[model samples]
Target: MILAAGRGMRMRPLTDTTPKPLLQLRGKPLMQWSLEALARGGFDRLVINTAWLGEQIGERFADWPQQHPGADLRFSHEGQDFGYALETAGGISRALPLLGEVFWVLAGDVYAPDFLFSRESVERFVASDRLAHLWLVPNPPHNPRGDFGITADGLALNQAEQKYTYSTIGLYHRALFEQPWCDVVPGNPQGTAVPLAPLLRKAMDAGLVSAELYTGPWTDVGTPERLAELQVD
Candidate 1:
């Protein structure tokens, strides 16, 4: 699932007219990079959660299936249903029906050109007992504090002296949305907004989350300046 529902407040007027994921990076739409990567990794179906100019996303990718033979693209319109973007977890929970038992998720607005959505990684995560496997990146300038830490055994730490930023790329199990880890009703009928950190932290405490440091080119294209940097690169 590609998470594309954010309002992109940081991007301001640029996002006022276009959803952040649809914003241009290099020569194509930002989210298209992830789509092409997933397709190259042998993933045939994709689910994108959208809000904040969601219709344009659908129209823009309407022919993606034809462009990539065997690829299936679908969207969950949070804005149309609830009038705003449901925060990360809420958006994921609402789209749970389409995601199935295990899936890969990444933010559509991030620039990670070197990241590969490998099938081996998926198989390894699926074989593990973990509920989620996140890719952690070195702290970027914008997020110097980082988000979480990893132990020798690779379990994600809720608190640690050395922390890393979540790359927003992960393999998740459907069980994470069930009782104990989360309480959001299936399909998020109430359209309740929920962030994913709380759930990840709770799971981290239980040793149900694992992570690996990803040292690759990555940028959270949340602002015009950051987007410009990528364009220049």
Candidate 2:
């Protein structure tokens, strides 16, 4: 599941018309590169959740490559920051049905290679039964607020350290969202805003979450300068 719908207020002018995922890095659309990587990772079917500028994104994949032929492609349009975007956890919660039991989720704006394997990685973490398994990168200088969890070979945290940070990318199991949920609807009326961080903290305290520090290049392209840096890399 690609988390593609965001206001990208940080990206202002560039994102005025184009959604952040559609913004190009190097020469291709940010998501196109991601799609190519997913293809390499052996992901055929994809469910993208979109809110802002969703039409153009849908159009780009209309003629999407044949590399992953017979690939089932579906788009869940969440065009409403006021009408459909369910924040982070809220968005996933609403789309859980479409995502199936355990699913891989990534932010559409990030461009990384070999992020997912050529085939599905071992289904190690249980979403319905256990805490989600997150792929975390070392806390970058920009985001000093590091989120971390140390467990006995599990994604569940043991030590209650508030210093380490969490990564935005993860493979989620769907049950930690059962209680203490957030607002899910417009105006957040009957809404759910279950952000991943606090949830991780809760699960960590229970020794239900696990983490792996990614030693690869993962950039949070929230700013134009970072986006520009990504473009040249």
Candidate 3:
């Protein structure tokens, strides 16, 4: 599922009018770039998860199947941000049904990048018993502390001190979210913190995880300047 519903506080005026995924770069919306990559990768069925200004973003594809005939594109509109925006895992929890057993999970903020990233990278995970397949990128300055550490064997490491930077884009299975999906305590304002790295690492340590690292062109456009910079490419 394409994650498109973030409230991009860092994206300022651009997000003021359009959702971050809809922000233009290289002559197309960011999510459009991701969609195109998915299409190129032979995936036609797509489910996008959205929240803030959900209607406007959903309206962009009011007749998506017609615009991109033969493609099965659908949207899941998350309700208003009454208190705090749903955390990453929370968003995934809410849309678990739409995603099914195995599907792609991607960040909307990143510009048009190689979605396939390296089918080999994902193949290892897909072949394993892991609940999720993660794409780990080299550490960048923005996330100096990183999130998940990786060994040469591609096993994920847990640490109290150091962590590896993980690209949010990934492939996930239903088992990982079963607990969150069924056990959510209604009216609990403090949402569950479902971090992608820790969960994947646990699966790895237990031999139920799968992962790979890619040195390809990947960008996490969390800031306005990075968003603006991608436009020139």
- lDDT to native, each model: 0.93, 0.69, 0.70
TM-score, candidate number 2: 0.84
Please provide, for model 2 over 84-164, each residue's C-alpha lDDT reduced to its tens digit, 9 standing for 90 to 100. 466677677667667666677788887666576433343545423555777777677887766665554645454546434
Task: Determine which window of 10 residues in candidate 1 has minimal summed lDDT.
Answer: 178-187
Tens digit of lDDT per residue, candidate 1, span 1-233? Answer: 99999999999999999999999898899998888888878997999999999999999999999988888888999999999988999999999989889999999998888889998999999889999999999998989999999999999999999999999999999899878788988788899999999999999999999999999899889899999988988
Model 1 gets an lDDT of: 0.93
Better of 1 and 3 by lDDT: 1
TM-score quality measure for candidate 1: 0.98
How many angstroms is residue 56 displaced in model 3 relative to the true structure, after the best TM-score fit? 1.3
> Which parts of model 1 have CA positions greater than 4 angstroms off?
none
Check candidate 1 and list the clashing pairs. none
Per candidate, the number of residue pairs that clash is: 0, 25, 2
What TM-score would every model get versus the actual structure? 0.98, 0.84, 0.84
lDDT of 1 at 205: 92
Query: What is the full ranking by lDDT, best candidate first?
Result: 1, 3, 2
